[model samples]
Target: MATEVYRESFERRTKTVRYLRFLEGLADTQVGPIYLGMWGALAFFSYLLCVFITAIGFGEQVGYNPIRFLRELPVLTLYPPPPSAGLRMAPLQEGGYWQLATLFLSLTLVFWTIRIWTRAVANGLRPMVPIAFSAALFLYAAIYIIHPIWVNSWNEAPPHGLRGILLWTNHFSVKYGNFYYNPFHMVSIFGLLGSTLILAMHGATILATLAYGAHREIDEIEKSDEGTHRAQLLWRWVMGFNATAYSIHQWALGFATLTAVAGAIGVLLSGPVEPDWFQWACRADIVSGLQKACVP
Candidate 1:
């Protein structure tokens, strides 16, 4: 009996290893190409979305967004008297609040997803329809990469005054926002959007893929096929949920894109942006390269 149990355990271990190896092989072949343009596009689109959100949500006063919090805190500063006599500049429109609020919310959502979505994916009840999954994959991955890059840009800023420091901390000015020299521009903004884009596409491509697959699964069931029907149904539900999430993700991306573009435009016209210190990382501005790898 002991010998038999040991043999069974060994066999199961061998099977598990083989399964992993098979999956790894498939991923290398199928998923490798997917990464090529997916990351770069993801970054560009998502960054745009973030900028749009920050601009409109916070209103034109988007520049002083961080000041609100800073002013309320322990720091004391001399209050400048309002424009003396008729010198008032059209009350600088201020509206970056919502953008900042949403950023926090989005961060929280990602945190919860790690706790919740990660577990769900791990449980094997994978619902993502292929196309939706692909698009969403593009969006979120970009968001993640951009966040860090943007933050680092702020910290690594060339020496400037307190105003510059404050502006860097918040989206006071995208040109001065510190991410002007992003290495991201070099790689091509293809797939950097990651999960955010994937989630957005989930509603359409993902939903369609799920519906088609589910309908076929149900048909198989009606034909008296057994065992896999329940699994198919579960997968169908997963796809639907993903579609719902993607819808929200797309909404966020749309918002972010508009915000970022507006910010980029404002800064570009205002003055010189960051000097490209890492020009080597910037891809050669070659037409062939653009056609071949940067087309997306």
Candidate 2:
């Protein structure tokens, strides 16, 4: 009994020491920055949430029922504050909440991105996650920041309601000519669809092979395990090639990253670069017989 007690005590001490050492290592690696960034992001996000809730309340006060607003035309929306409002807080009806929400949102994204980068670096992982996330951030900035700045009006940015954003998108497409003809928009759509297809294919393939005892590790599958072997053969027969476990992940990452990157590029190019995608398409001979309609 004494021996067993000693052994337990020693084991406990060893674990405690290891935990302390791990913490020390984390400190040495500057985990504080990660925590700091996360806290900053959380704070901003919380504030933004409050702003949204308040905006909803204001929407209700404006005689528009929150629940039924979607059913009505001219849908309830939190519009951007006028430029004349400056940085001062205005009444909720004057768009003060939206301006504050936008500011908090921008800060939240920045801090969250920093946290992602720091955490990935501390864990010795590739920066692919943060890099892919940056593309999404770029798209947001293009729509809310860059585009507004280019047009010299914050009102150019979308409002803070579902139908509001939909209306903004329709207005944007109409004012800038149909976005369907934009090459970047086409690429983005292709990437988005391709990512969805790849996700479905990979998930279905795995599930289909599971019944065949294909739950082994990738290395085991590569060694001609019966179930995984059949899977490989099935894919080879259907597509003339098969993706290994490693390669399938690469494929997923490429498609997902391309979707965001292409979307950002499309948003950035929409007004400043192309101005009118439909008109450009007509000039490029990509479409004909609609020049009169594409005059805008």
Candidate 3:
């Protein structure tokens, strides 16, 4: 009985040591439970705060009925209270909840970006994920924070709703003499549409070759597999060039990143830098015969 007790105690110690070693290895990876847990908690709290604020806005605007809230969701807008509200806590209808929700959402984004960067570096991978994500984050900041500061009015920021966003976009374009003439905006459109096209091509190529036992098309491409080879040749014939399995992803990432980068630039330049995109285009000689429309 003494020997059996000693064996059980030894086994327990061994298991504990193994668990500690596992945790140590995870920590070394820079994406351990602690990092993930903090990120998850921040994200969850941000989401909940936003939901709570939206619920309150909906209840105040369209009664407490869930069905009514759902029906009116498309038209409901949560306008941020005036700057007089300041950083101090105010009533829910006076933008206190919006401020809290925005604060937590910003924190969530910062932590999420850090998590992506640290995890990528620890794994000896390129910083593409974080870089692309940061560009998107910049666009969000440009709309909600940077541009608002530049214009000296928080009201410049769009309200939190579907129709509200559309209304904001319309107001922006009308006030600034049309956004289509903005070169950065044009580039963003190209980037977004080009990324979609690239994704569809890549997905279709993989699916098309799946029937020929080319499920692992990326690996098979190097082995000169018939299905992958044919797919590549088909694209080369159609487009005069083709991306390799590895290069295709890089191409997609480039376009996707360009979309946000261009959008952020355009947003930053809208009011302070140029004020009117149509006039800028006319001055740059990109458009003609619309001088009358370009009048300020």
Candidate 4:
């Protein structure tokens, strides 16, 4: 009976692999992967450019400069405020800029590459567990990495840990009018959302790939055809988990979306009013980050 069951299971798995492969063949157009890959690369490079810009001011002993400020400022005003001013101003740490630049450049670049590669693999129906793990790892890095750099750049020191996180998010919310505010900062919640979208998609793709692999593996089990059924069940569960995980990032996206809608409505409802300096900076970061996220 066991042998009979095993035979049936192997036959089913063989059939499944053939089906998936057939699906791959049918979509012979290079367009999907090409476009997805291109968009991902575009988003990644743009983020890098923005990072470079952001780092330049603070990367040096003097931090937080707008390249534009130089072209427009009087020669006397060229110097950034002291570090305590919450501006990443003059007197860069010895090799601090190099270390900071290298860290961000490597982190974003590596994650970007890993994301695109895993996407390619998932698109091709290869096993993709490594890729799924990579996406999650990147998010974990963001949660840890982003806060510290931001706190340091501030004129004032951050309180500590979760306080810092709440402070940063809250600062944006009030200063920029929402959690997703990136207007003057030019690093919009939108780009972050877009990046988040990419992250979510990558996570989904990874799970799909692994499931496909597992599907093939389980089909070869020797138990009654029950094992074959279990494989199908397992595949769905993996897929479900991916969908759920990806949804987590979508909340951030949704917040950004709401801000956009509100901004648009405000524009239609009222002409622009001059906001204060803090607002302007907040807006600049949001906008700059958004544009940079698409660089190259």
Best-matching candidate per TM-score: 3
Q: Candidate 2, residues 1-296: lDDT per residue as tens digits?
A: 55568656766655333233566744532221124455556856766685675566456656656566545435657777686754456676677667767777777787777778887888799987888888788888988888777766677788877678899889887877888888887888888898899899888887788866676554356565566677777899999999877788788888887877787777777777888888899878787677677554
**What tens digits encode model 3's per-residue C-alpha lDDT throughout 1-296?**
55568656766655333234555744532221343556656676776777787778768888788888889889988876576754345576877656665666677788788778877887799988998899889988988778877877766777788898899889878787789998999999999999999999998998888866466554565676467787888899999988887799999999998999898899889988999888899888778777676555
lDDT comparison, 1 vs 4, better candidate: 4
Sort order, lDDT high to low: 3, 2, 4, 1
Candidate 1 lands at a TM-score of: 0.25
Question: On a 0 to 100 scale, what is the lDDT of residue 85 in model 4?
Answer: 44
Alpha-carbon lDDT, every model: 0.37, 0.73, 0.78, 0.43
Cα lDDT of candidate 1 equals 0.37
Off by over 4 Å in 4: 1-89, 93-163, 180-296
What ranges in model 1 sit over 4 Å off?
A: 1-103, 118-214, 221-296
Candidate 2 vs 4: which has more TM-score: 2
Tell me the lDDT of model 1 at 174: 46
User: What is candidate 1's CA lDDT for residue 252?
Assistant: 51
Give per-residue CA lDDT, model 4, range 151-215, as digits (tens).
Answer: 44432222222334456446534543433332322333354466567556544544555534423
* Model 1, span 124-235: residue lDDT tens: 7553333333334334433322332344321222112245336443542343323433434322232335435654544344345553443343344354323234433444
Location of the lowest summed lDDT over 10 successive residues in candidate 2 = 25-34
In the order shown, what is each candidate's alpha-carbon RMSD? Answer: 18.8, 8.8, 9.3, 17.2
Those runs of model 2 whose alpha carbons end farther than 4 Å from true positions after fitting are 1-75, 82-92, 288-296
Candidate 3 global TM-score: 0.80
Top candidate on lDDT is 3
What is the full ranking by TM-score, best candidate first? 3, 2, 4, 1
